[model samples]
Target: MSNDHGDEPHELRVSKIRSGTVIDHVRGGQALNVLAILGIDGSEGEEVSIGMNVPSDRLARKDIVKVEGRELSQDEVDVLSLIAPDATINIVRDYEVVEKHRVERPDIVEGVLSCPNRNCITTGDEPVTSGFEVLEEAVRCSYCGTIVREEIASLIDTA
Candidate 1:
């Protein structure tokens, strides 16, 4: 079946995790940001595999992240939606996909992201946690009313 067409059907195989999570359909070039959101810096011995700017049918280009030995929390997945709204989270167990779901935006996010406003109350010495109300495409600081619409993942404080 050697045809003259330059295009040919193909498939890529990424290793499967025995137990953990696989985040698929991430917006291309945001794989590093996804790692940051999950607090993985390579210093904590997190087993991670990433494929960026890969060919996709659902998107022009997409990224995939496979994290070993860990399942994401609801709060973590909520923040993920801020960047990769179309991502599909797959929970693997015993080399099988035990569960799969899409990330949903949360109404509020607390104690996860750092407010950029230096004068905001959450940045002060007072014992107050950061809070933000999730918007349609952004997040509004609950304390200082600062709206963040760009580089949302840069405000992530996984520490």
Candidate 2:
């Protein structure tokens, strides 16, 4: 079925992966962030493909990331939820989608984000891991109660 744009029917521009994860419907402009979260530098010998600002019926514009020969860990997916909550994860094997689901924001996020508060224990030399309560518009530090509402990309602890 052709759309009103008269453009050719949308197709997967990237080749299918033998086995890996395909993150689709990512918020437009956030595909690079997803790649960052995945720690894929494109130098690790894995086939990685990214499509940004792609057309989407649900989001109008979206991004997609295809990683060949690897699957995302739960921690990685959790971090993704913070950046692209509405994104869908597709587990592809043998060029077929075996599993598909949308990413969900967990009630508690840990270790992935550094508390913005300087005095927060997470920032201190102590061994406390950062913890936050997932809120609708912000994440509240469980230690210092500091609410992080913006610039989440900067606050993410990729270590």
Candidate 3:
């Protein structure tokens, strides 16, 4: 709806993906992080589309990511949950949505995130994978009891 100034809202039109994944309702500004988690920098030769700060009724604003000709792996989805918990994954095949689901944070996250504690076993050459217990507002390192509260994107291990 327009305000008293009589300015009409413009519509956003994004092309549909024929056979790939469409992530919608990304927490407004986390689309880039999602791309990073997928290791997609637009240099891997895939058609990647992103819409940031789009109007949304549920979130007031949201972001959307569309990747053509590729499906999201479980690991990628897991990482996305940490950044955009309310995001939804849409599998499009032949320009039709074949599947749709919301991203869920796993109880146990491993390898995707690096523990903030430098003294943790995962940080040294102990050959232990980084592990964390997913909490409501933060993730706790399973080995060192260090809690990560912010800069989650920087801590994501895209390798």
Candidate 4:
């Protein structure tokens, strides 16, 4: 709405995804990583729209990725959690949000991913797997073993 004082109406940047998921609240600089993990590029060319360093009321700066005509699998969501835990996944169909979910990290992470550590066995070419157990709300990186503690996970403060 325009103000009587001659102030222009604020423009809202809203777009339709057509189908698939809209991942919002992704931490800045992590959108591309999430996209890579989701294998969005491996699939047939889908309309992928990304907005980085967007202003957020909740997070001072946030990122968003919208993929068209593709619904993400549960495994994909789990991968998203590893990189963007505060992410909000919106299932969009016909330009409407059909379902919304907050990404949550699972307790025991299996073959789902390789440890982020470069020197870890999982990161090696030779096919050694890394597994972890959630001991007291922290995910321990089993191989080159380190802990992403609950406190670290909970520190989503983008301010």
Largest TM-score belongs to which candidate? 1
Better of 3 and 4 by lDDT: 3
**Reference-based lDDT, residue 111, model 1:** 94
Per-residue CA lDDT of model 3 for 1-159, tens digit only, reads 554436976555577778999999998888888887888887779898888898887899999999999999888888788889999999999999999999999887888888777788888888788888888878889999999877787778766
Instruction: Write down the TM-score for model 1.
Output: 0.92
- Local distance difference test, each candidate: 0.92, 0.87, 0.86, 0.72
| TM-score of every candidate | 0.92, 0.89, 0.89, 0.71
Error of 4 at 31 (Å): 0.9
Candidate 1 on 83-148: residue-level lDDT in tens? 999999999999899999999898999999999999999988998889999998899999999999
**How big is the positional error of residue 47 in model 2, measured in Å on the Cα after superposition?**
2.3
What's the candidate order when arranged by decreasing lDDT? 1, 2, 3, 4
Worst 10 residues of 1 by lDDT: 1-10
lDDT of 1 at 159: 62
Candidate 3 has its poorest 10 consecutive residues by lDDT at: 1-10
Candidate 2: where is the Cα deviation over 4 Å? 1-8
**Clashing residue pairs in candidate 2 (N, C-alpha, C atoms within 3 angstroms):** none
Worst 10 residues of 2 by lDDT: 7-16
Cα lDDT tens digits for candidate 4, 1-159 = 775547867454446677889999998878877777766564567688998888776788999999888888886676568778899999998889999989887776565554556777767787675676545545677777777753332322111
* lDDT measured at residue 143 in model 2 versus the true structure, 0 to 100: 90
Pull out the clashing pairs in model 4.
none
lDDT of 3: 0.86
User: Model 1 misses residue 45 by how many Å?
Assistant: 1.4
